[model samples]
Target: MITFSKDFLWGAAASAPQTEGAALVDGKSPTVWDKWFELEPELFYEGVGPEQTSNTYYQYKEDVALMKKMALNSYRTSISWARILPDGRAVNVKAVQFYRDYFQEMKSNGIEPIINLFHFDMPWWLMEKGGWETRESIEAFAFYAQVVFEQFGDIIKKWTTFNEPLVHVECGYLGEAHYPKVVDFTRAIQVGYHTLLAHAMAVNRYKNSKYNDGEIGIILNLSPVYPKSTHVEDKKAAHITDLIYIRSFLDTVVHGYFPEELIQLFKTHQLLPKVEEEDKEIFQRNIVDFLGVNYYQPLRVQRPKKEQFPAQFPSAFASHYDWPNKKINPYRGWEIYPEGIYDLGMRLKNEYKNISWYVSENGMGVSEEERFLDESGVVQDSYRIDFLKEHLIMLQKAISEGSNCFGYHMWTFVDCWSWLNAYKNRYGFYRIDLENQFKRSEKASSLWLKQVIVENGFPMTDERKG
Candidate 1:
């Protein structure tokens, strides 16, 4: 049997900006998403924006009830910075009460809440003030963290400073798929540096605050890098990709320092962000207590095909390679590699002091899932069940071999809006009917997961063991 610890957390994760529909209600200000959509509605998928999501702000009670129905012991969600501090100045009393009541509901339902302070939803005012590119913006974020910790720290014991800070840097600054759409490498590095500094500052605040009993962490979307071939050039390309994408943030948050190679490389390229003298001390002193890993796919890279790609950032050193025999999620185009989970676990155990962590986000996203709905109106998503089971088998093997993994939380509980893609891909245990009155229904995977949670694992059949 593939067994997990009795205390293992079994749940799902969602974010306020993705799940909450009241974008403009109760003194909430616009996030960068709202502003971006307003500026260029055509850029988003089918005119869908962040304005109307799953409507969890009002239906949080129903959402909690659904979580209980799925037998979830824990649930991870983010507090919208814009919702709480709409103007980026003072507290919004109504927003505070709303979150307090929502969290209290989760606690009452036997659900442990893992709350994240930021999830790429920068308040428009803060973004206008230069976002994370400026030290002033970093300071504002730390202050906002202090405020959130002060208000809800007593209820939510598990906290995450940011969800996928790298995505914020890459998508917004480098890729132009997200808001502000700047493709400058220098600005991207600065934004990434300041964001990490913000995380460290928040960790410092939470550790020193009265809520020290609670554990604090950061969610990183870590992809294990692989070389395209055994050639020295390919290996070198993979190592550089690992340093830039993985170690840059992972090392600093866990080991209290940046990778020396990364620093030197950035310095050589004149891409280093401005650093204050006291920042190093703060980072060393405020290392995260735990980590939340959002693993979707591994990276495969080879030596740069040309001297300089259009991006001229990491592409200058490495080029992405499509593995010949890789399985893929056709709907989303992400490589589906279950073994990568095991690889990540072993890497953490061996190199990172065996830090306590959890699978904060892992799930299969399918496009137009309604095509698979059964006659009873439920989504018969057996593909998701198979996906989860395959990943769990690998995860169980990792834990058996001594990885300090504590839990598994899927990408989301209900279908929620994804940035730019909007609802193009559905990744949820409960299918939210956008065409209807935002009604939610269960998928086959939710039922399968409920049983797995009840048993603390699944039976290891011959096929699974193989």
Candidate 2:
């Protein structure tokens, strides 16, 4: 009953820093993660750093073959800015050849490549120049994006300027989780504004480039905001939360402007970032062709009861609300709300001109997955299969009801290193045995997904029988 369209993109996504283990190899310079690990090795989980990842740089051919075996129509991954442009200004020919072969291998294996220009990894040299906080960094990013389009634009038809831009703004500037950790609300807004500007610049560049035949988009980690109750203050807080987290990037890229309410709030609080006279026009002129949404959980908020530690933080307007008895991923501690996908889809359809979108990343991460390995060495992860089915069923319903969603890509194809968490959690169709020479074996969920891809969708009432 829950069948997707014939041309639906059934795929998976991973980032360069997480998958490519050759962190310092072949003209690849240091990224923020590299420096952060160097500065504080004790911070990362189990002291595991970016150097010990899935080794996709060396094993991309085998990875692409696995994608073919799984019948994937697409695979989304980021081009390491540091790897491709070692110093953020010069192109690395070695990195270019590696990506060329990697992407070509995917195409040869019948998989379409969806390439993202930047994920959380910023070239350390760029960070030294103030990263996204300065206008210079924005221009640098535009130049880097241009080089990427020129290099791989023929092979990579689907492009994303950045993935989860808000994460860097919040995690890096507003919180201590990421590099250049500084608790500065004013700097956070600047970083976010500059990043959006860079995206607009990249979109404009791509539009006027010789490789203008393909589409360009930005990937957002969207989480629907829910008020704890129908109280006026709670509703107001929820709306503010939505404006901050979702609409900040979503509205700007799709509607070519930021939310006026968000602007007013920032102005009232004196948290506004400096802007150029031409920036407004620049944003109004450039809009994305499509959207790639990465949804893992929804945000529940209530009116703040008291002043938060960081008085200027977004949490001052709305505090987190723990929904009682909500189903959760124990390992990740994230609420499992499949219906959020339906709600998000409906919002896009009704508000955002029915923009074409796809689920760029969705998967369950479990810690200590080796405990689930059977005698045959396969990770018997039915939990992940159920998670995929439940989410996809909701997505299918949304599409059936006139949502313009075109595809669904899980979080990753193989288990890769997560920043900070490192390898504490595993989220992949192919389990990577770090101890056994990083051998990859398909999990039960992957087998189920292969059948779903083959059928274009899975049955709602019936199970995938052996």
TM-score of each: 0.98, 0.98
Model 2 bad stretches (over 4 Å): 307-311
Report every candidate's CA lDDT. Answer: 0.91, 0.91
- Could you tell me the lDDT of residue 153 within candidate 1? 88
Candidate 1: where is the Cα deviation over 4 Å?
308-311, 462-466
The residue-by-residue lDDT of candidate 2 on 140-162, one tens digit each, is 88898899999998888999999
- Model 1 reaches what TM-score against the true structure? 0.98
Lowest summed lDDT over 10 consecutive residues: which window, candidate 1? 457-466
* Alpha-carbon RMSD of each model: 2.0, 1.3
